[model samples]
Target: MPRLLSLALPALLAALLAGCSGLPSRSTKAEKSVYQGESFAAEETFSRLFDANVEDTCEAARRALLSQGYVISKAESGVVRGAKHFQPAGEVHVEIAFNIVCVGDGPKQQIATAYVSAQQDRYALKKSNQAASLGVSALGSISVPLSSSDDSLVKVASETIPAGEFYDRFFTLMQRMLRENTASR
Candidate 1:
């Protein structure tokens, strides 16, 4: 009886833990997704090949982002990051981040490739109780700001934008930027 109880206890605990496992199940086919310049999917990539040097590629990306009304927040040696926010309807806001990275192709030192990844996040307005300080601290009670935050409508959805038309237009614009940059110099 004691041996059976011991084995049962461990089996029960193991079963509970397995039931709560957060790992993917065997039947689930997780698609490869890339966020920013990082690739979470080993088999998937959304990068376009640019035949320019790293510096020129990154600069072109920066200009392309700015042309589209994206705010350029960071520009570094081989990486450019930008974001844009807009509201299409009431109480709904959408944000997109553009992450571009330029690197040398493994087999070709002279050839550099620029990779672009866009991540999107959606948010919705929410209302919550707040204690407004009507000029007086109402019997020494502190007041909290009424509003300034919102809840994410969904988990941040990230995917590589490898659509032919989309990337073709994007690369064409980037090429124009690269040409302009060269001309300016």
Candidate 2:
């Protein structure tokens, strides 16, 4: 009985150690994926806008109107809002909303409001293997999903613009209409 007990104890100890050794590797992989996904989403969205010079784009659009001999009597601060989602298959989708208000005094005060929405569907996957092997960087390779669809792009844009800008423009136009009516009297 003593001999049989001694053999069983060593085998049990060996099995326990083997299980513990694999736990750290699994934990590390999960941790890496979470951190990488967050960083990748942030970098993708901001980089595109900043690179495309969105500020410049807005300013230029404003300037073009001004050059046409229309005075800009008042301009309101623009608003931006957006949300992002990530998929298990390694894709990220983003939706953005933008709004601007501008008013001018002519025969009457005229207001122009513009709304825009945009989306980008691509993501970079973290180079987990390289990160583990190199031990120097955590950045990953970027990829576009094979099955990404453009359906959401238009839907997002439609929601962003029509209600906000259309109503704003209508009110501004109404104000002008009222002023003209009063003047004609």
* Candidate maximizing TM-score: 1
lDDT score, candidate 1: 0.77
The alpha-carbon lDDT assigned to residue 175 of candidate 2 equals 43
TM-score of 1: 0.59
Residue lDDT tens for model 2, 18-137: 998877665466455534644434323221111112333334334433433334443334333333343435333333222333223233333233333333344434222211222224
* Model 1: per-residue Cα lDDT at residue 128: 51
lDDT, residue 20, model 2: 87
Q: After superposition, how far is residue 8 of candidate 1 from its true place, in Å?
A: 29
Clashes of 2: 0
Error of 2 at 138 (Å): 71
Computed on alpha carbons, the lDDT of every model, listed in order, comes to 0.77, 0.38
Each prediction's TM-score against the native? 0.59, 0.25
Model 2, global lDDT: 0.38
- Writing each residue's lDDT as its tens digit, candidate 1 over 45-127 gives 55766767788888899999999999999999899999999888887778988888889764655557888777777777665
**Candidate 2, residue 102: how far the Cα is off, in Å:** 12
Flag clash pairs in model 2. Answer: none
Off by over 4 Å in 1: 1-45, 106-108, 129-164
